[model samples]
Target: MIAGHGPLRRLKDGTAELHQEAELHVRILDADATLTDYRRYLAAMFGYHAPLEDALAGHEGLRRAGFDPARRRKSPLLVADLRALGEDPGALPPCVAVPPVTTLPRALGVAYVLEGATLGGRYILAKLPPQLAPLRGRATAFLAGYGAQTGACWRAFAAVVERVLVTPEAEAEAVAGARETFARLIDWLAAQTRAAGAALREAS
Candidate 1:
């Protein structure tokens, strides 16, 4: 159901429950989500992605595996979206509890989560309600993600995983990275959301 075959399918299948649980945390796609809700979601995500990407930088294995980390950099896009929505990306706290990406296979595993998000981002953008519709071209670059290139980008990433992770050991490490990425993101968002809610209540 997660699509793809070989390592790609393995990664997706392994992390399926964690993926579903993350959606429960990311309420932006809900029918009642408001503009504020969307803003909060992007802000929380920036907090997660900024540090994760920073840690992921300089990992030569990603390049050797045929995927340039630079091409898939997501923090810049998140920053743009946050700026458009009137938030200062610089002031936001980045997640310190990031997944370990010290190895090539582990990095690819971490990447699997980030790259897969683009596919889900399209679905959210398409089904977004009118309340969340105004973000379209301006504040949704993070979600808009490669626009028409998302499919090809994901396919390319999947291929890289398949080709690079030919051994069972490498695939296992990738799965570990994927699971850890999901776990860290879910925890970070949960914490950020609680803090945001408390600040809002205090303001009122």
Candidate 2:
């Protein structure tokens, strides 16, 4: 149980390294990446988010914290992106398991990882090639999920997390959940990248 100044701060500080590693694996930052790169990235996102969102669905902790599971789902956007890119949703690989969220503190921790990605998506969206403009709204919906309301949505989530994680022990649990989620995402992305590379080699 690592203690910190605040729950959110602790989660961020604790997961900073894992966050950076995940960002490095994200395709949006690759300058030489092509449309194919984006497609694979979206597919990977779909694989990672679909299962996690399912687990979070109708979670009592989320509802009590004023977090609507429906609006927060990113898998649909990932699916739409895959479709817009001419990929079959059914062909995508299965998502990895997410950390269990039986408690409010743990739920908030997992939600934190998902919601926080929206903020980073803003940056990813901006760096997208000009040729990708047409897909911005449709294929890139996951990145631009909240649009201008992104900041507001994050603030609202933060408020709920703060309310739910009142004690030090609760905060530690939240941080642990967040860390586990981040690690899982990193592993999933690495596996996706490896699979993509193997496929490319087979094609060549």
Query: What TM-score, over all chains together, does every model reach?
Result: 0.95, 0.92
> Backbone collision count in every prediction?
0, 0
Query: In model 1, where is the ten-residue run with the lowest total lDDT?
Result: 1-10
Worst 10 residues of 2 by lDDT: 1-10
Q: Which ranges in model 2 have alpha carbons more than 4 Å from their true place?
A: 1-5, 130-134
Q: How does each model score on lDDT?
A: 0.87, 0.83
- Cα displacement (angstroms), candidate 1, residue 183, comes to 0.5
Per-residue alpha-carbon lDDT of candidate 2 for residues 28-138, written as tens digits (9 for 90 to 100): 656677888788788888888888888888696688679987678988888878888899988887765667877888888898899989988988898887656557777
The local distance difference test score of model 1 is 0.87
lDDT of 2 at 58: 61
